[model samples]
Target: MKLFRQVFLSIAAMLAVQGASAADARLPVVASFSILGDIVANIGGDRIVVTTLVGPDQDAHVFQPAPDHIKSVARARLVVVNGLGFEGWMERVTQSANYRGDIVVASQGIAVRDRVEEEHDHDSHDGHDHHHGKNDPHAWQNPANIVIYTQNIVAALSKLDPAGAALYRKNGDAYIASLNELDRWAIQQFAQFPPAKRKVITSHDAFEYFGAHYQVRFLAPQGVSTESEPSAKEVAGLIRQIRKEKIRAVFIENMSSPKLLQQISKEAGVTLGGKLYADALSQADGPAPTYLKLMRYNIGQLLAQMKLN
Candidate 1:
């Protein structure tokens, strides 16, 4: 009888250890950039451990993956990326790391706006041709597209950790509701401006999605990628266009240099509209620390620049 009791106690200890191990484990997730990292955190909450490769105010357009990032991706149960060709180096990094985990494209199913369509939309009133790329990967600029992002994130997280599915869905639903509200708010707010007054200049052509949704026309001296420089002729044309259009303000992006934009503003005789967050979020205490705050802050800054507020 004593021997039997010993064996039972040993089994109970093993069970306890197993339970503790299970309780201590959390889902590991890796996101390509800061904006997507925030969205994943919102859905995952404390149920997952998230690592962001490109952090706040960091430019993913020219991000270089570190060894630490490879290590993180190697061990992560799931990897999240902004697909629309946004993370140009992500595939190579994952391949180099031999990351075998599931990769979820957060922007999946979000209607991709190619550069040709973007140029057509921007210059619809005119017959000017724009030398642009084939794809514009900044879909998150539109709050409506964020709905698709939240859904994709929730689905991916739920699939990876079914036990935490309910919590992820709840968080995702709440966040998406906020996005919907933001969409409505932006529509109403931007409606205050007439089409003629909705034009502005930004550092890069990152706001095509935002412009499509908000009826605001964004003109940029540089192409979609900040890594590329605008030629002298392009700059001259932009200056002429700004002067002709009476574009009141030219804004600098959070992740781009203000020198070129400042130069454009000076030569174009326009005010420097406050810095806008395009590719990444700002520091913790800055105007656009969070994704939601980023959208609101951008609209507010632009509206204030137009004296519409």
Candidate 2:
């Protein structure tokens, strides 16, 4: 009986040690927003635990950090952010949190474009301003941009947890392949539409990357940034342009309030392409809950609304 008790105690002790080692192996990562968190979750898998600074469907453009967010940041082993001035509130939060982890800027390798004059002005925005998103904080609008985001995440994770480097690389390669497949698939699906009818009217100027990549036109009331709202004059002008160009399907952005766009649509006699995932992901079980689902939802909506007439 004495020997059996000792044996049982030995087994329990070993189990406790094993649990501690497993816990140590897992990284505690913090992402600035939901989309970044999802990307981290995909590549990190079981190797890392990710926490999103901004919850689902929350606009990172206007996000303000809370006490809990600071605590999350301070606890993180690595911090991943969209950068390109998308999360204006993050720097202050990180400073307050006094975090010492490596900060990963996900947009490092993306090719950025300038915003249009009517919807944006060079002097109107500077670094660390949401308006700086004039270059399109909606980089995920084009899947190819996500390749760079994945690469940054992989590099940062590898640096923070070298043991999991191989897994991160392998996962990133697989995800990139899937993105490439989606890109080709999008091209093929869009080929069904005529070129003259390829033009689109979105609530904001958020789809230029998608337009450029897929050979479609994205006409917008606001410029390339969802952070900006147009004046009534601008709306009137856009309405006139929509009629003049015979634009089809004005889309409502997932992150922006749809009131202005809906009013414009009413006056213009154009259908509102409901709920596009622009600057953020939707809450799960909603439309565009995931990146894959977001793309599919947007494309499906566009297809349903777009007409050759």
lDDT of 2 by residue, 18-95 (tens): 999988778999998887788889899999889998888777767878899999999999999888677888889989
Instruction: Give the TM-scores of the predictions, in the order they appear.
Output: 0.88, 0.86
lDDT of 1 by residue, 1-309 (tens): 999999999999999999778656978899998888888898899898889999999999899988999899998999999988889899898898898889999888988887742232333246565444577899999989989999999999898889999999999999999999999998999888888888888998899999988988898877788898887877877787788778885789999999998898898787787889999999898888889999999999888876621
Candidate 1 segments exceeding 4 Å error: 1-24, 117-126, 129-133
In model 2, state the lDDT of residue 111: 96
lDDT of each: 0.87, 0.80
User: Relative to the unseen true structure, what is the Cα RMSD of model 2?
Assistant: 5.3
User: Which candidate should be chosen as best, given lDDT against the real structure?
Assistant: 1
